[model samples]
Target: MKNKSIQIQEKHHKELQKLSESLGQSYGGLVEKMILYFKRTGIDPDDLKNESPTYKIQQLDKRLVSFLKVQERAILKPLRQETYEYYENHNKTLKEAKSLINKKIVQADQNSKIRTNNILKEIDKQREALNSICEHLDPANKKGLKTVFQNIFKNAN
Candidate 1:
């Protein structure tokens, strides 16, 4: 390594020496690392030291961007996934409920039709039985039965 000396204030030199010792590095290495860090990050040490508004705004912007990215990853992504899953499950449940209701309605319609047909058949049998009874009755008995039926109906009304 080429050894060279650069003039600096005594206080600055002493501070640099202390930093180098604490970090267990040579003065040249420490200074080179500091320069590289500043260059890589596109930071101006003078801007930081001067506390410029523009520099403060830039730092704030970086922090805000970082916070947004973290929120997106840690909160937004999972919440969105859970919501989508719930939406899908709710839709599926609705479909199942609709299908079940439709099946039940169809079954009820079929049962009602069967019951109606059976009731019609029973009415027809009762009409036939009444006609046979009328045919078997003598003229006098028929007259008496008709009078009794009329009186019963009149009382009901």
Candidate 2:
């Protein structure tokens, strides 16, 4: 291995010596370990005391969760409300259409019943006339039957 030398402040060197004693490592060994740790993790050693990678990651995670919540409130809540309203409107329209159809069906049924009643009344009137003519014919009066048929034809006109 090659030897290299670098100068540092006296106070910083003493602090490093204290840390090396606590960690049971020589000063040079501690410095080597620190350099390896910073290089491998891409962490800035000067900013370690102010903000660590763990703290930054936690902050980012919290920001992500808060952003998701904001997006939900801003985007999804109104969409859900609009969808519900649209559904209700369609449902109401369908109900109204169904009601109209039912009313039309009922009116058609009533009209059919009235027309059927009128036809039946006409049929009953014709049946009474036929019965009356048949009664006159029972006596075997041909002239009387002919006179009754002529009167019936005149009344119809």
Candidate 3:
């Protein structure tokens, strides 16, 4: 048989040469290996060599379907149910946590308002007591009123 040569671009030829060198094989050896691999896999090398874009897309789709079917039969079964339950529990927990936080916030706000009101009432009572003492003081008993005021402040401290 007469040997024929396939012409390739310089860049592609250099790439092939580099690949062959890296694999420790000659160009002819690489070609032979590829032919053997295609034969063993029952794939026609000519079909791949002249593959159209549409044909390649169809082949890819077939591969994807097969891959998905395998996954559906194996990994997806356990994960699908677990994923649903996880999200259900997660949403329920989140709602409960939000309700608890809201209740705590409302309670804290009510407590703050109650404390403020109590402080205002106490201040009013103190002002009324001071006014009463001032009104009850006798004009001739200034020293006695001053002593009483001092005793009140001392008791308070």
**What local lDDT does model 1 show for residue 108?**
100
| Residue 15 in candidate 3, Cα distance off native in Å | 47
lDDT tens digits by residue: candidate 2, 5-68 = 8799999999998999999998888999999988998877677475777988999999999999
Overall local distance difference test of candidate 3: 0.83
Each model's lDDT: 0.84, 0.86, 0.83
Q: What local lDDT score does residue 53 receive in model 2, on the 0 to 100 scale? A: 72
Best by TM-score: 2
Sort the predicted structures by lDDT, highest score first: 2, 1, 3
Q: How do the candidates rank by TM-score, highest first?
A: 2, 1, 3
The lowest-lDDT stretch of 10 consecutive residues in candidate 1 is 145-154
C-alpha TM-score for every candidate: 0.50, 0.65, 0.44
Worst 10 residues of 2 by lDDT: 138-147
- Per-residue lDDT tens digits for candidate 3, residues 3-28, read 66889899978988998999999887
Give me candidate 3's TM-score against the actual structure: 0.44
Q: Which is superior by lDDT, 1 or 3?
A: 1
lDDT of 2 at 39: 93
Candidate 2 TM-score to native: 0.65
